[model samples]
Target: MSNDLIQVLQNLGRPQVLVLGDLILDRYIWGDAERVSQEAPVILLQADRSETRLGGAANVAQLLRGLEAGVSLAGVTGDDLDGRELRSELEALDVNCDAVLVDDTRPTTVKERFIGRAQHRHPHQMLRVDREQRTALDAQRSETLLQTVLPLIEKHQVVLISDYAKGVCTPEIVQQIITHARQVGVPVIVDPRPGEDYSLYHGATAVTPNRLETTRATGINVQSSDDAFAAGRQLCEELDLKNAFVTLDSDGIAVVQANGDAELLPTRRREVYDITGAGDMVLATIGVAMADGVSLADTARLANIAGGLEVEQIGVVPITRDQMLGDLLTGPRKTYQKVCDLDELAQHVSARRQLKQKIVLTNGCFDLLHVGHVHYLQQAADEGDCLIVAVNSDASIRRLDKAPDRPLFPQQERATMLAALDAVDYVLVFDEETPHALLDRLRPDLLVKGGTYRRDEIVGWELVESYGGDVKPLSVIPGVSTTQIVERLRGQTILKRPAVSQAHAPERKAG
Candidate 1:
């Protein structure tokens, strides 16, 4: 099932994604909690450093970009320094900033969280101060945002309405985006606000509401999947939503389709942390997956995994495609999380280039796990600090006429397994038969190829060398191949095969 879902991700094209809603800046102040003050009873904070990241709807754009989807963000930010800084941050991630408007009346929504650590241990959030407004965007500014966002809806395959209820997602603005998006036959996914009035988001393709918000919006006591489903159904019915989803905190997520079909994704077991942006991650994943034509249930599972990954982090961390796949195998790593879109790849490359890090890229159809793949991956890892392994999806493998019943495991599973290894820093799945386009996008410092291929014979070698990137070729395993494994398994009795450790040969190397 995981493999099947991963196949959907592999087949996902770089569809344009538009995010419309409030823009916020999240600030984290880290410090040490020492002795109390001499005059008053206040704990002294020995400040260390502070950092800022995108919040609210802007965060949805960041996650989409990390997932390799083309993203355009439309929202309103105050004309203060924070607002300008927020725009800079979005432009840094290569998000289209033209639609991000500015108003001088209100301040940019800033959620400043103070985290304190004592006695050199793990730090915890102590306090939070929000500096912003919750009132509706002024009439003129609202009209301006509508004018800016209406045209953007027709240009995108998917639209996300991230309602922080910070005034940007007014009824007028919501109606304009949703109405135009529907006219263009695009899916409009809404991350609804927490209130009884859901009419503001009416006509959206799907609505994602947490347990609390779902209960408030539908006036239902959501204690179980059945109750959540009831609430979701009510919301879907009221808002004419095609997909009704209720996110249950520890239990899981429940979805009620327009046809009344309901399914609950059981909570993937994990340690919970600050669920700051889990809902945002869920909404983004489902929106993009829905646009990509994935099944409703699989997209729910994908969203569930993304939410789980987000809570494990301290704050709003963008959920990337690689991180999403990596979480399916195990968990997420800081550096290996994002799989950049072509537009955003330049930004990541520029950042990496500034850091002077070595990049090694390799491509393969890693259908099933084997020792040879791991050994080659490790060899590839040795060539650079960051190793990017691009796997071919089941469809892509079939398109290449690689083998019958190829990719026993789905593309997601292959990418996840490879990313679970310590040697691999990132994994990308390409549906294209030839990775020449992907190579052109990345143009890594080193290109690694396995299975006895000469540097000159390898795909994209010339392109890599064009940018002074070298190509490294390695040997294949003595007697290891997916076909031999399948043949050996078929050759032996089904029950007997499980008892045997080696499928193809008497000896097998550890993967």
Candidate 2:
């Protein structure tokens, strides 16, 4: 990555993200599932605890806050108890809720989900009751919402429209928001409702639709990756959107960009606990990352990791920066290896494998040791009995970096650093660019990297595939990087060195 990009990512903080659309409350009733009740055929839920959280557009705002983004929400809510609670929640998150209009004509939208759990079995959702209005917002109310939101639109870097098909996201409101956002040069993203016409989201920068929503809106049955790519592309073209992504549960996400590239981000293998607000987490992370100047590919990777983290916890929970940092630190660092002399590295790999121990092979250059690299190696160790990190030599670094003064640390120093990490079992230095030859010989059970690279982008992927081994990417820390630290140190030195020297000269003479 370029120094400028790294600097931008490290300083990602509180970029204004405007959220306008359907506002709702997500209430969860948790308990154990026992025998059926005498009065009905339904299983009895031994009530344990219940909680209420911001849902719909409100949940999106919470996600933005969790990612350390400054958020402002614009929508309509009922003038009732639920609306008050929703407002309080937004306030607690430090989100600007002044644009959330209160109307007495309808009740606040609430989805009450009753979950039943049992030991050694999967928790099942027994019932979900929703309170909402499907009708369009009144002309006066729509105008009122526009009046409140239009002025604030120019203040944000990115605008998100989270519609749940509630009256708040009328056709007129969506069109107005899109138009104003375009005029002001703010990127607008949408999490659209199912069965709703895509025309409502015309001119949006991007729209994230789940599998069912995509199928319903595009009239395309997505069964495979190709089908998903085709559907996503068709939808983007039809809607005139700059980008479109369809999130397939357990199958990862498919993205179609304006440049006509269909990219598939495979799902990270995980045991899901709860899927509540997973989509919200994805949308918020991607939107915030993009606003913070991360590339589209990086944004997608962050979203995938955020979604994976959300499903590990119960209820409508937000993934915090600390949690993301921890996750990135606890996994194995992934490497890209290009092989020039496969036979040479293969010989060394075979000799090591003959010892009868589980060989964990990971390849990457340890140019700058950071917390993210440490966590990735630790996570990779958990996948196998031992870990091996192959470092690229100085020549190979020049090939990959395309810079005369790159590889901040030499190969020997880099290998020694990797060896010092407790998660790493062994460290080897390779002169060539790719590690395919080495991987073929090592035949490791797992190949790991930081979560930024797509599966298809991994070098030696074919070798791992042939050997029945899996390749995984760990999450990247949001605001941590070696380049940023170096730049800061350099800037500080330039600012303070002359003053320090001048001040110390008199003291030295006195001594």
Candidate 3:
């Protein structure tokens, strides 16, 4: 099953997914709590940094992009700076926000969380304050939004409704969306709000509700698989839904279909740090998989894995396709398996950054794989949690004019040699003479170079420093060098072998 899913992921082409719901801006004020307030009993927080990210349905769009889906977000935000920033962020990720209407009457939904840490430990949320209006939109504004969003359903393969119980997800809009999408033969999935009256989401294809929401809607205590199945079955029957998905925190997801089929898809136990956006991640994964026409069981499995990966992180972090692929591997991976192409490495780097891991990158033409090169890479690895070694291609080395025939090995050989070392987490071959383009894409946390050049003279130093990344120079081993090794080999009487012709070369297996 794991292997099957891996094949599914490898061929999971980009599918257009339409998301409709409330848009929110999540703001975090990070600080340190070391002292008490002079006049009050609250801890005095010394703020250091502030960050803003997408929330609510906007977060679902971001997650869909991370999963390699073309996303279009349709919702409402206030005609304010926060709304503009939210739209800008989505656009940066290539999400279509043309349907993101603005209402000057209500403020954009903003959830401001104050986080504090003591003695340089892990940060925790101290308090959260919400700023917005919850009243339903006026008749005029609602009708205008419906007119804009109704036509977009035809352009998408699937429609996802993320209702945070905000003013945007009114009864009329939800029913119209479902009815219109059904008429066009498009599936509609809803992440319903926790309430006893779920009639707003009736006649939908599927509905995803957490345990609390299911328990409330079905009047059943969802503690075991049987309980969850009972609740899911009740929802599917009462709401006329084809399927009901109940998320059971650590146990997994319980799914019940209208045809009297029921099953509990168990999830691997993960260390729960923060489950801020697990539901959104699950919704995004389902939308992508269903768009690709994956089976419901397989889609549920993928969603479980995505949601599990989400909880291991601190806050609302997007899950990437590479992260899913890495988690789907059944056993330990070989060192050579770490060798990746440019696109795969970029995806892995994005996932690592979301997990708060530091990345270190270094580049060179490691032709012979000597101790000096190994020592430099080990030092670079010590600077960060993950070290990526970018090897120069054979054509690039020749362009550098190092010598008449400088590189003794091919790019594949050099990359395999580098991947065999414990210090390197990933090895990639670049055709560029300089690592500038690679640096721009990976954006490593630290850029390390091993040579006699000064810190400022290193390539990409300015580019690295521009993004708050550090640049350093490792100590060059004086007595050992690849040039010296080649000279010594030339002095020795070595026997040369004839090159094998293409027809006589061994047949290689398909990748």
Candidate 4:
């Protein structure tokens, strides 16, 4: 399952996606709340920073762009500064906004949130103020929007409707979009607004509704997967959708197909900092996968993962393809799972590098794990986002000839011990003397070693530095050498295994 998901993520080809719905500008005022306000009983917030981000359908389009999809956003915005700024931001991300319509009568939809942090902690939302016009668009403007966007649907492989119930998604426009998209063999996915009547999104390829919205639409009061499936089934049947993806917050996504097949696609539980744009991410992920003709189950799974990743962040940060691949490559935090072969390790490193995460690598025999090794590994982990601890193979250790009898622990046991450390992100055993081959393949951003040796004397230092990689030397604990421990054990009447002769030795290596 991991490999399959990784493959899907690796092969996410760029597809043209059309995004149509309400466009919003999200404004955040950031500050520290240090005292109470004298003017009122509310907490006093001294604003220090402010930012504006694309929201609603614009957020979906930006998310698609982050996933390497070509995106065209079609939506309505007021002919004001906020609208212009929103379009500029979209254009900066290479999103095509030629279809964005401007109306002079209304103000741009803006959601302003004030965030306050206390005692240098994570910021929390103090309050939210919304500026929007919920009144439905007039008939002439609605027709103009339809005429402008309907013709462009055929140019795209997938159409996404992100409805915030902000007047852009009228009944006529939504229905026409789905119908026209269907006629041209293009799929339409809707992130429907919370409303009693979902008929506006009828005949769409799929609908992604959160639990509360699903309950409101289906009247099922979804509290579990069973209820979610029932609610999703109702949406698919009543709205003529091919599938309904109901997102049940931490419970993951429940997918129900028109053919009565249903499954709950579970997600890894994340420390949810904020759920601002999780729904938009899910819709974007599914749209991109659907554009490439991925299966419904796989699409839902990818979307589920995307949503989980989005909530782990503080705001509407887009989930990139590399981030998804990295999450899949590094699954559960199992000690055994951290140990990988050279080829698998290369794949994991590639994913991390794509996500712009630094890779710190160190190589040693690690025959006898001790506090010194743990200390070094912990320091190495601080050098980058992930630490790759390379251990020498048993044969390599034997060829090194540290003593007549060396490497008391086998290579597998040594690697397992290293993997069990929280500081070690990945463990691999190399047969070669030095990790020149591994370093050349992985090209880690930082090469770390624990010893008194200078950076130039470290193994693979020159090779690593040749490619703009850094080399760092750490302090080792005094009198903590494995040879010293082995000698102490020998003095205590410990039995030693027979050493293999050098006759069949592949080559000499050192730790």
Candidate 5:
């Protein structure tokens, strides 16, 4: 039984994860806090930009998607603009929103935050306002949610409930989903509401409540890991949960199992930018790991890493596959703050273009980190304001006529290593033999490659040149490469062997 996280990550295929709870639309209004307002003591803000992202259960679904998991989100939303936008975004990601209901009584929940960005300091939340109907779900709506969730529970590998006390996650709905999931043997994980009765969430496989939440729910004043462990064990016992974890903000995650076993896993230190959806990140990570049959202790560790990465960003940012892999392999990699998929890359570059910044792109099989790779990346970074490196997947290396044992490092590790470098603003994996698909999507301001290949022979050079994008070929460091290192090792192994007769092996002496 190997406990290797990379092997687990490899085996944790795209399991269908069903996320049910309150769906919310989070809007961020970003601007500069230029001066003090005359009318009041509030700061004067020149709002320049605003954006909306999935929130609550929707945020969980998005986070699962970022971790490269198959997700389906179920909840209630009004037939309003925010509802429509939320559904459209989920559908665009191929998330199954079929079970989501359009209700008439409530407006779609929208949490709007006005944030102020200063020149030297980090962005701060100026104000937040929410619009929603907080009334309990009507019996008819409860029945609708139960019917929608029951059939899908068995279809998915695991079920996650993200309850924010919104009308959608009533007791009836939660119980029905839990009962059905128990019947089907699919584990149910719940992110419960603070100060509420955990009785409704009984029989869950696991419950993740934060420090303050544990204090409120169980009356446990948690100041240390020991207190958190006590709270977790008590909550698990009262609710009949198989496992319970209390998220201690900076200290770490303390988890307790029903068997009376407990452990506190400290989180990786990172810059706490904004903790908007950190719990969502933890819940989603647990859902993914649990569905793959990982141990609870390992699951908590991975969730801790995910939450740490979550707080390193300014908004409700999703922790990407590479970012987590980077955290697992090379500690914390801050450059992941800019890494994203092609669609997001397009949006990111367009915004950067609005800010009049140049975009540079380069693709390679950066296996086995060395000085050469770093310098090459640095040279590519010099070509533009933002550098995007596309890493070739291991399978892609095989298709490139390389040796069967090529790519000394896995694709995720390679991307993670690249993301740790200061020169790299973003890293994406391209599985094809060439990066033409990524090129077609990005159409970057500059295309860069190693000088080993002819200028005309470079892949995507013609397209880049045609679009007025410059193609740069940087000189690689001499006599240093992954192939050279591998070959040298192979030769050393052969030379170290005892000499044998060239014609044939001598007969063994009888003992």
Candidate 6:
């Protein structure tokens, strides 16, 4: 993917994402398990902190907003404390909750989890208490939700249905939404509830079902990759879905298309902390990427990476664009290092240069690294004896990024990561908008970029050329970029929904 494509994906700034389904609140209670209770055999807990987050369809909207997409949520939230909390969380994430109807008949879906922590072991969940109504939404409420969301759907490229089996994703509502979305040429992606008849999602562009859900819905045993592929194909054909993506926990994903072509994506290795809200992350990311014009195969690859990142953290954590980009940059390169300071990094670079290395230097805020960036960096590294990467300081990154929450990774850490690579010999940290002054100081033997423009396109290209340094063009990596990575990581997987198959099943590892 060219840097321009990455830029296009990042600058997609607010492509409205329509969310229709059950809205809920996720409440987490963090505490320490110290002793057994005197009256019961339960472990006594010392509470530390409590947090409330958007859940269900509300979470889908939040995930879209996290990817910098304009999000509008249309769902039913009860007139209760949990409902209010859900609204508050959505507003905080900048998601439009105006269409969120306040239903009085049902209690808002609230999943409360109690987490116990000790010194060195993994945190364990004591209990998950759920409050919800599984009955269908009333006619009045269903009409109200449709009236509020249909117009908004016309203006967006993608629609997401998040069903928690909480009655809000009624057959009438889902069918109406999907029919309308298709009429307007908008694609609808659904995270389906298991055991619910697939008829509700009759015309959806795609459906994301976890292994267990796919098994239950299709009555196919998903104990192996072959079973998953057969089950996915059956579900797709039976439901008339454009695609069926079956998420196999740890083993990765199997995608089955309407045409019978299946593709299996292997899971990335990770030390999982909590699996909460991983599906939401995948849904939001795939939706955004497809909306932004990413291909299906590329979208699935990005989603896999995003899902991996989310599972590494606890609870419902939003994966930032910068973090996703960083992953893309590091994914193709295996060399890693830990450097404490700039002096140390520079010394490392000098040592590499001393070995007659042609040092290729390039600098950027790299606030959100994408495929364009990885391709550029890798190509740049290929041109020199040793690639010297210079990153803008936090202040510079903020100046270039504008957003306060940007550059998820600080300069020092970013530099350390870049320096640890075998392709990179040194990393320089600078506080300037342009790397002109730094280039003058470093006087690298070569400078490179991924764009089609001549050396003049780089801000410091002239300086390097004037200093008798070589300026070169590096071929852009197709279909791999930072922006796409961000969208994919944020849970959008529709356009590039993976093809499911047992023949191409993912390799399994022993735990």
lDDT of each: 0.79, 0.76, 0.85, 0.87, 0.81, 0.74
Best by lDDT: 4
Arranged by lDDT, best first: 4, 3, 5, 1, 2, 6
lDDT of 2 by residue, 196-303 (tens): 478989999999999988888888888888888888888888888888878887888888897789888775677798898899999998789878777676677667
- Worst ten-residue run, lDDT, model 1? 502-511
| Positional deviation of residue 474's Cα in model 1 after best superposition, in angstroms | 21
lDDT of 6 by residue, 42-110 (tens): 987788889888778887787777788888888888888878878888888888887888988889998
- lDDT tens digits, residue span 351-430, model 3: 66755789999888887888888888889989987899988888888777666776899999999989888888889998
- Per residue, candidate 4 scores C-alpha lDDT tens digits across 1-511 of 5656766788778999999999999999999988888899999988999998889999999999999999999988999999999999999999999889999989999999999999657899899999999988999899888889999999999999999999999989998988899999999999999878888888999999999999898889999999998888888889888999999889888999998899998887888999999999999999999899888888888998888899988779999887888778665768888898988888777777777889999988887888878888899999889999989988888778765566788999999999999889899999988889999999999998775567776888889999999998888787565655665777842225323222112212363
Candidate 4 stretches with Cα past 4 Å from truth are 1-7, 31-40, 79-85, 117-122, 295-298, 312-315, 319-332, 355-358, 382-385, 394-407, 431-436, 445-475, 492-511
- Candidate 2 global lDDT: 0.76
How many clashes show up per model? 0, 16, 0, 0, 0, 31
Q: Against the true structure, whose TM-score is highest?
A: 4
445-485: candidate 5 lDDT, tens digit per residue: 88877536556656788888887888777787766655555
RMSD of each: 11.1, 17.8, 11.4, 4.5, 13.0, 18.8
Give the clash total for candidate 2.
Answer: 16
lDDT winner between 4 and 6, please give it: 4
TM-score of model 4 (CA atoms): 0.84
Question: Pairs clashing in candidate 5?
Answer: none
Segments of candidate 5 deviating more than 4 angstroms:
1-3, 332-511
lDDT of 1 by residue, 29-143 (tens): 9889987999898878788999998899989988888778889998888888999999999999999988998888889999999888887557778889999899998888888
Which residue pairs show backbone clashes in model 3? none
